[model samples]
Target: MKPSFLASLLLAAVLGAGGSILLTHASPAQAQTSTASTDTVTIFVDATFGFRKKHMATQLTKTHAEYAARGYRYVDMAPYNENGDLVGFFVTYSKQ
Candidate 1:
């Protein structure tokens, strides 16, 4: 009803609207990151006898080809170890 009270109410409404807008909108980078995360799949190869370079290389090559044919691209590869022993490998692929 009073002038000061009306001004305060308007300010509060503006601040609330701005906060809601900010919280509801996502940046481009964040949107892309979330999309990329969901579009990626990790392939794990089990090696009971430990990782041999030649065998692992051949297996990875075949895997790359298989995924590539399905419109996927290689993203990353890392060795998986357990108790100080080389166990297998984790290969990550993402949709192109």
Candidate 2:
């Protein structure tokens, strides 16, 4: 092969390798995000009786406060009851 042909081949190989390195280094911003998992869970708070209702209120407040500090938010909620009385609340929390 000619000397010029060899030089061009080497130049192309070098440029390809350099481009690969640059691409690897260029995407660091994407890697900096979200090592923590996005997750979901449902918590059941019972409000069966007068004392239970009070306890459930405090517990729901405390649970929300705890999860909020850890980047969790309410996704959905359902109130469960028998007849006209409150039975429980199912609160869905998500961290995204």
Candidate 3:
């Protein structure tokens, strides 16, 4: 094999490994938090009705405020489903 080709392959391999490591370490805690959020959303959806995206957004905002007042960090609010009469919502938060 040509030297330049070998160097390029080596660089690619190193970059790939570095990227994998960075991605792995960067979000382990976030991933756990995301799992927790999914659980929370499932619970919230199960306990509520008429959860449209717009309504969920407002509700999540209020929930975040309430949680924040109690010392929590809000990560995000995502709409899972939006079919007519069957809506789903997910709220994500991180501990402060």
| Model 3 per-residue lDDT at 42 | 18
Candidate 2 runs further than 4 Å off = 1-37, 49-52
Instruction: List TM-scores for all candidates, in order.
Output: 0.53, 0.50, 0.39
Candidate 1 Cα lDDT to native = 0.67
Q: In the order shown, what is each candidate's alpha-carbon RMSD?
A: 16.3, 21.5, 13.0
lDDT of 1 by residue, 1-96 (tens): 899999999999999989844533322111123363468777676444232445766777888999899898899988876667655677888888
lDDT at residue 78 of model 3 (Cα atoms): 52
lDDT by residue (tens digit), candidate 2, 1-96? 999999999999999989855543342111112335667767666565343466776877887898799888888878876567776677877885
Question: Candidate 1 has which clashing residue pairs, if any?
Answer: none
TM-score of candidate 3 to 2 decimals: 0.39
lDDT of each: 0.67, 0.68, 0.51
Where is the poorest 10-residue window by lDDT in model 3? 39-48
Ranking of all predicted structures according to TM-score, beginning with the best and ending with the worst:
1, 2, 3
Q: Which candidate should be chosen as best, given TM-score against the real structure?
A: 1
